[model samples]
Target chain A: MKLKIKDVEFKNPVLTASGTFGYGNELEDIIPVNELGGIVTKGISLKPRMGNPPPRLAETPCGLLNSIGLENIGLEKFVKEKWPEIKKIGPEIVVNIFGEKIEEYVEIAKTLEKEGIRCIELNLSCPNVEKGGLEFGRSERVVRNLVEKVRENFNGVIFVKLSPNFTDIVKISKAAEKGGADVLTLINTIMGMSIDAENMSFKIPRKVAGLSGPAIRPIALYIVYRVYQEVDIPIAGVGGINDIKSALEFHLAGSTLIQIGTALFIDPWIPFKIIKGIEEFLNKKNMEFKSIIGYLNKKRG
Target chain B: MRFLEEKSEIINLIDLGKDYYQIVISAPEISKLARPGQFVNIKVTGSLFPLLRRPFSIWSAKENYIEVLCKEVGIGTKILREKKFGKISLIGPLGKPFPEPSPEDIVVLLGGGTGIAPLSFYAERITENKKIFFAGFKHLPSPYLLRRLEEVCETLIIATEDGSMGFKGLLSELIEKEFKNIESEYTKYFVCGPYPMLKVFEKILPEQRTFVSLEGIMACGFGICMGCAVKKKGENRYLRTCTDGTLFSLKDIEI
Candidate 1:
């Protein structure tokens, strides 16, 4: 039920994905915040973001397309105005940071370090933004550079959230490892689009948006399985993780941690359900947590 | 107060005809939490195909039940129309409520099409004010809650674009004329409809005294997804429709 990446230890393997679990305060009344592994906050930037326009989300067949553009309280206000409220909830808060430029990411990281933040998730893979988000995540060189710069000033655990839009995810995973990432989260939402055939118009205002929910689970699992074989750093599997079965699939695919995204919208208390289900599954199998990780790739035959 | 996610069973699903329908569900917890101007996010099907919940403004809330006025506009709503009776998932009552009107104020509620849903609920809550309900329709809707709204309001007016049942013209035009004649000392306006009607009222009404309940395709009923972002008037930032408001001060928002 515990997971360790670099120096910090997670109480469980189940975490809430960034941009899905507000600032860990909205659902605190319903879901016990301190019980889960951790909670990654919605993506924050150096300055306050208003996000995209109306119609930022659209429902697709078995999925959701979103172009929220990472609306968040800027780093200054988050520390000054929001941090006290967030801290009171008592979870391992992983502040998810994004930037329009490399320097902006470093500035936010330095601010996080100053504020005594224990962990930070570098958002190199948000598809909603028009700036240097997904572009930095897919390119190996950019990923390495961004991570290296944040790693220089911030001593806390850094998780590099990567994009699934990449052609070779393993190469990107290696790039984060080479840049001294404590852990890597794979994968962010996959870029997809839907159209209104009768109107001949795109459903989302942004022609393409990140697709999440049950539709992207298989793709996330395949990427995690491939990257686990190639990288040494711990992997935080994300995308389409809703129930205990899907959580086990990630662990079997070699992920030490799993984060639930769009599913939180459906049920905010799902983390508790998933955590309890996992405990029962392990008990029935008469196995330990380690037995599940890398189990699929082990010498079974 | 926090919202609740409840398993509600369909108590009534009546076709109001012309593709419009009324869906009433038994959700005691949500009924207690619901206030006027707020909405509930309903999961149309208990399947994975339609991944997101459809948001509906509260039409009525009694002791242990809630009502939603719906029109079969798309695949999700179309599926919702077919369900006669069963259990479904609902998360609500989400968003801020309409501002309370003062005893001396004349509260004007303007609604178009299914937009009449929340205003009818609003009328039922205000007992100290002079309530006026203006409802507009494309054609004669089969059997809406006009009589119920009439009982709640001091006055009621119906307008139809095709001149089928009431005054012929855009509801906005009627609203403009009505506002000019009534010139009360303290007046508050609550309006909801298609975007175009909202935009028209934005120009006609005094921004400070008007509040508008807006709609957008939303994923989370809370603030997480930022799916319901509404542009702030004369400002660079956006306000979340689910958290900041489904009801926003007209002076603060663009439309």
Candidate 2:
């Protein structure tokens, strides 16, 4: 079950995706989060965000569309308040940082480095926000430049989370690797909107929100499959992973690690289920854990 | 802040007519700790189309079981309304409960649609108090639910928008009229209904004493999603309905 990327040895290759898990303290009583490889905190900005207005979430078939707008307590409060509780949890805590400005991202990274944080996941793919996020993710130059700037400020492992919205995902993945990212979190929620026919308006007031769940699983897996072959850095697959079968598909498609997002709303215990099932499958097949990752890539026609 | 995710067994699903139902489930742990105003998020027994769990107010909680007043409004309830027997996943007793009423003060409960759920739960708990439970509907709800509700309240008032049954007026009108007949100085109001109903009371009801439960477009039913947002009355910020409240004071929030 041990998966090591550089000096960081994760207990399992399973992590809770950013923005879904709060500050990793919301479900302490309900789920065995310590058993997870890492807990990704909500995206923290330089200042506290009140988030988007109400009617922020809507359910469409097997997925959810959210315009949460990356709501979080600012970096100052995160380190002063949330970090104390999150650090006590057994799994590695990855502080997911977001910023509207490149300078803000550099400042946050420098602050986290000084605070002795082990890892930080850069959220360049959030579709709900106006300034940073998807704008930064779409341009290959911006992705590489921002990662490089943060890499200089922070000595810990840096994970760059990218989106599959419009631009070439392969181009972006290669850019993150070239910019000194330790790992690449493949595919944030795809940008989407649903219309309420009765009201003759958009389901989400933001007009466009991030689409996540099983609906986007195939997209995420394909993105990971494509990006894995293009970059040398490990790919942390995210988007629509819910159960063991879905989790394993990512590994075969070439995800070194996978994050559970929208399904956390459906079932909190899914991570545990996937973690145990992966170990069982590995033992049954008599295969090394690492051998299964991208194993299907070679077989695909 | 703490809750249990119990695999509750479905004891029965009784149709109360007029699109209302009483779903009784076996959940000992949840039943033991649950109070009025708190809710449980339940996933339908054998379906997945309605991916998110539906949140229901605790209509009743007895020795080893709990009930929710289910109204067939969407795909989630349409499937849930027909589920007679099996196991379903339940996560509760969530959110803050209504502040406890002192025996000396009078309690008023105003409800309409499925908002009658938590008020019904509260009515049973505070049966010993001098309470007035006003159950409003566009037409009459089933006699079973009405009769059961009447038996629990010290004084029960049934109001309908249409003249099908009881006082032919909105519950807000009924409450306003009742205030003239009954003393208003010491009455503490607990209202749960649609926004139009709640907003009307925010004007007529005493802000300091009135507590209203607001519903949100929920996903997790817990605090993770940050989806269920309610604006604070005078502040430029938001509060999560799951964590901060599904229950709030009339004076503290804007609708």
Best by DockQ: 2
Q: Which pairs of residues collide in model 2? A: none
The lDDT per prediction is 0.86, 0.87
- Minimum summed lDDT over a 10-residue window in model 1 chain A is located at A125-134
lDDT per residue, candidate 2, A12-41, as tens digits? Answer: 999999989889988998888899999988
> Candidate 1, fnat value?
0.79
lDDT of 1 at B95: 86
Give lDDT tens digits, candidate 1, residues A1-301.
Answer: 8877667888998899998988888777766889989999988899898777767887877888898878887988999988888877876889999887888889999988998898999988743244523477868887898899999999999999987785588898889899989888998988899888998998887888899999998998999998888887788999888778999999999888899999888878889999999899999999998889878854222
User: What value of lDDT does candidate 1 attain over all alpha carbons?
Assistant: 0.86
